[model samples]
Each structure stands twice: as C-alpha cells, then as structure tokens.
Target: MAKLFEPFTIKNITLKNRIVMSPMCMFAVEKEDGIVTPFHVTHYESRAIGGTGLVMVEATAIEPRGRIRPSDLGIWSDDHIEGLKTLTDRIHAHEAHAAIQLGHAGIKAQTNDIPIAPFSEEGTVTAMTPHMIDQMIDQFKVAAIRARKAGFDIIEIHAAHGYLLNQFLSPLTNKRSDAYGGTREHRYQVVKKVIDAVKAVFHGPLFVRISADEYHEAGNTAEDFIYFSQEMKAQGVDLIDVSTGGVVNVPINVFPGYQVAHAEMIKRGADIATGAVGLITEAAHAEEILNNQRADLIFIGRELLRHPYWPKVASEALNVELEAPTPYKRGWN
Candidate 1:
C-alpha cells in the first residue's frame, strides 16, 4: 500500500488515509444568513466520495459580522446546525471523517460591520475589550459544541490567515497594551483561552490552522509556531494544520511543499503531529513527505478543487489499489 493510503489516527478519530481535503472557502452560501447551501453539500460530498481520508470544511464564522466574505458559512446559532448536520452526514456516508474550521475574520472581515481586533483602529474597529474577548471565547466554545451536535469528527480553530485569532497572535497586528497584548505569553492568552474553552466543550480531536511564517521579519516564523504548538500540545490540541504567510498582505513565493518544511519543524520541535499544506499537488510529492515523516498528513487545496477524485486517481498513479464509489468500483483495495 502507498504511504498516502495509510491510516492516520489522532485521539479516537482515525482517517482512512493520509490525504486530507484542505478546507477552502467555497463562498457558496448565497443567503448570508449563515446557512449551508446545497452547493456546500455537493462541494464537500464530492471530496468525500473521491475517497479522501478526511474532509475539512471551510473557515466558518462564529458570528455573522466575523464573516470573511458575506457569503461565507457560519455556526453562530442553533439554526445553522441542521445544514451542518447534512454535510456531516454526507461525509460520513462516504466513509470520510468531517471537520469544520471555526473561525472569526476579525478586522479583515469584508462585511460592513466594523470588526473588533486586538488593537483599536480609528474610525473602524476597536481593540477587543476584556468583555468582548471573553464573549468571543464563549462563541468559539459554543461553535465547538454545535460542531459536535452536527456530527463532525473534528473541530479546527482558524488561528491563521490574519483572521481574528491570528490578528491577536501576530505582534504587528496586535498593539494592545493590556494583558491580552505586549508580551508573547500574553499574546497567547486569547488563543489559550479559546483552546481551553473548546476543549471544555469538544471531546473529539482538535486541530488548529496557523500561519507558521507571517513572511515579514517582525512577523511570526516556524520557530515561533514551534512554541505555539508546544503550548497547544500542552492544552490537548491533537494536530497543527500548518500553512504559511497570512498575517499581513504580502507576496509569498509559494511552491510545492514549501510549507511542508515548516510542518516538519513544528512536528519535530513540538513533538506533535502536523498536516502540511501549500502547493502540494502531486501524489509522489505527498507520498515522499509521508515516507520521510516530514509531516503527518498532506492537505491538498487547489488541486483538490480541480480534482475532487485526486485521492482515487492518486491511488492509481501510485499503483495502489483503492476503493472508489460503488458505481466505479473497478479497484476496491
């Protein structure tokens, strides 16, 4: 069997293979009411049917105003649970585990509502007050609980991509003088609180997506993420879905597996499992990473978008027989 087809287990949740469908926003939620549409159902189900081990849903907002795009999916209320349950059921029916990235866009939100952040911005948003900070933590906890109720197998914290959590984590974006700011330990306080809150409500495996390299010299780097990963590990985080350069708007010289090195660093340094993402398209490349233990899982994004059956096709490319959908069961290994 190919290494990519090997099962991976974190906590009690075990994936059928090492290939994970990286959560990419579909922007298919047209109603802007935080409900998952039929588009989302088909979009995610396609990947699961393609035989991915795990299918991570996109960055879903915990609050309406926290949406990155107006059409972005959300989990702010009980009303959103049913649509999410449909998605979970579709994924499970295809024998793939489901995960949803609980996220808040923060100051970067495209919506007209002013976003709250770690630092107050003039004529726009304000630095999060202690009360607001506590509320957001509870929101994350509630979102996690909702995810569990929706039948998701995992919950991912979107602490990456200049989002609310990353804005707090990045020193350049966070300029608060309070306890939620200043020192590195203090900057981590919000994330620590979010993690604790989620763990309190979520019993399944927890994952956090982080930009290991913020690209700027003053921004975060792989080494910094090593520390963050260690802290999350201590807090019972099961995996780090490693991505790079989303703190500030800057050009990134991206290439295949460019972020895999970062994942390897965090994995070895933090002694924790990690999922490598970024331009990792080819099966051989993904297999090599697994073969060398560079990362625990390979998160395929754009390629997965272009080829929903990438995993099934990859099995053929690697000459490892893998099961396909019932109608296409020529290879059922």
Candidate 2:
C-alpha cells in the first residue's frame, strides 16, 4: 500500500489516510454572522466525499473581534454549534474525520473593533491586558468545548500565518517586557497557556499549526521551533502542523515541497509527528516524505482546492486502488 493511503492514528482518532485537507479560509459568510453557510457545507463535504482522510474546516474565529476577515467561520458561541455540527455530520457521514482550526487574528483582524495583540502599536493595535489574556485563554477553552459539541474529531490551533497566537510567538511582532516576552520561553507563555486551556477540555487529537520560519533575520528560526515543538510534545499535543512564513510578510521563494524540510527538522529534533504542508501536490513526494520518516502526514492546500477528488488522482499516480463513493464507483477508475 502507498504510505499516503495508510491509516494514521493519534490518541483516540484514526485517519484512514495521510492526506489532510489544509485549512484555507473561504471568507464566504455572506451575512457576516460568523455562522456556517451552505457554501461551506458543500465546499468541505465535497473534499470528504472525494476521499480526504481529514477535512479541516477553515481558520474559525474564537471571537468576533479575532476574525481574519468579516466572513471567516466562527465557533465563539453556542449558536454557532448547530451549523458546525451539521457540517461535521456531513464529513463524518462520508467517512472522513472532521477537524476545525480555531484561531484569533488579533492585530491582523479586519474587523471594525480595535484589534488586540501582545504589545501596543501606536494608534494601530491595543496590547492585551493581563485580564484580557486570561480571558483569551478561556475563549480557546470555550471554543474547544463548542468543537466537541459540534462533533469534530480533531481540533487544530492556528498559530501560524501571523495570526493572534503567532503574534505572541514571534519576536518581530511581540515586543513586550513582561513575562509574556523577552526570552523564548517567555514569548511562549501565551501559546503554552492556550494549549493547556484547550487540552483541559479537549481529549481528541490536538494539533498546532506554527510558522516555523518567520522569514526575518531576528525571527524564530528552525532551531527555535525545535524548542517549541518539544514543549508542545511535552504538553500532549499530538501533531505539529508545520507551515512557514506568515509572521511578517517578506517575499518567499515559492516551490514544491519547500516547507517539508522544516517539518522533517521538527520531527527529528523534537521526536514528534508533524503534518507537512506548503505546495505538496504530488503523491510520490508525499509518499517519499512518509516513507523516509520525514513527516507523518501531507497537508495539501491549493491543489485540493483545484481538484476536490485529489486523493483519487493521487491513488492513480501511486498505482493504488482508490475506492470511490458507492454512487460514483462505476464512473470512477
């Protein structure tokens, strides 16, 4: 069997294959109400029906002010739970594990409210007070509760792409003099608290997406992420979904499998499983990564967007028999 088609298990969750549909925001909430819509239901359920092992919902905001855009999906309240549950039910009905990326955009939030971050930027963003920080941790805990109530099998913390948690992790943006700043461990305090808070109520396979390479001279390097990965492993995180370059936008040289090296480094350095993302579109490359023990899972982003039935394409390319959904079996292969 192709490694890409092999089952992977972490904690109590088992993925039928290594292909993970990377979380990409659709920005399709037409009413700005932060509720799941028909478009989202169709968008994600199509990938599950296409044979994706794990269908990750987009970066869902934990609070309205934390959204990256006005239309991003949300899990901040109990009202959001019903719509999300409907979506998860569809994915699970297709035999795919459902996961949600809980995130807060912080200073990068595009909402009308004053954005919050680790440090205050003059007239730009507000520094979170200690009480606010405590509240933020509780918000993540509450979001996890909603995810469980929504019937999601996994929850991924979005700490990458220069979002709220990434703001606290990267020194380029986190310029604080308090305990949540200065040293690497200090900078990690907020993320650590967030992880602990989520793990308190979430027992499923917990994943964290991190910007392993900050793309700046003073930013967190591969070595720094090795430390972060170790800390997350110790805290019972099941996987580190490795993706790079979002903390501060610098031009990145794009290529196929460019970020796979970072995932491999973290896997070896911290001895933790990781999901390799960033331009990984080919099945052979994904198999090679897993076959060689470089990374445990392959996260396909744009390609999956372009081709919802990407796993079938991968199975054909890898010479594996991919069983299509019952109704489409005669037309498939």
The most accurate candidate by TM-score is: 2
Instruction: Tell me each candidate's TM-score.
Output: 0.98, 0.99
Q: Write the per-residue lDDT of candidate 1 for residues 1-97, one digit (tens) a residue.
A: 8899999988898899998989898888877898999999999999999999999999999998999999999999999999999999999998999
lDDT of each: 0.91, 0.94
The clash tally of candidate 1 reads 1
Residue lDDT tens for model 2, 1-333: 999999999988889999999999999999888999999999999999999999999999999999999999988889999999999999999999999999999999999999999997578788998899999999999999999999999999999989989998998998999999988999999999999999999999999999888889999877789999999999999999999988887999989999999999999999999999999988999999999999999999999999999999999999999888999988895
Q: Listing every candidate in turn, what is its Cα RMSD in Å to the true structure after a full C-alpha superposition?
A: 1.3, 0.8
Candidate 1: 10-residue stretch with minimal lDDT: 324-333
**lDDT score for residue 255 of model 1:** 78
Q: Residue 253, candidate 1: how far off, in angstroms?
A: 0.7
Return the clash pairs for model 1, or none. 120-127
Off by over 4 Å in 2: none
Sequence-dependent TM-score of model 2? 0.99
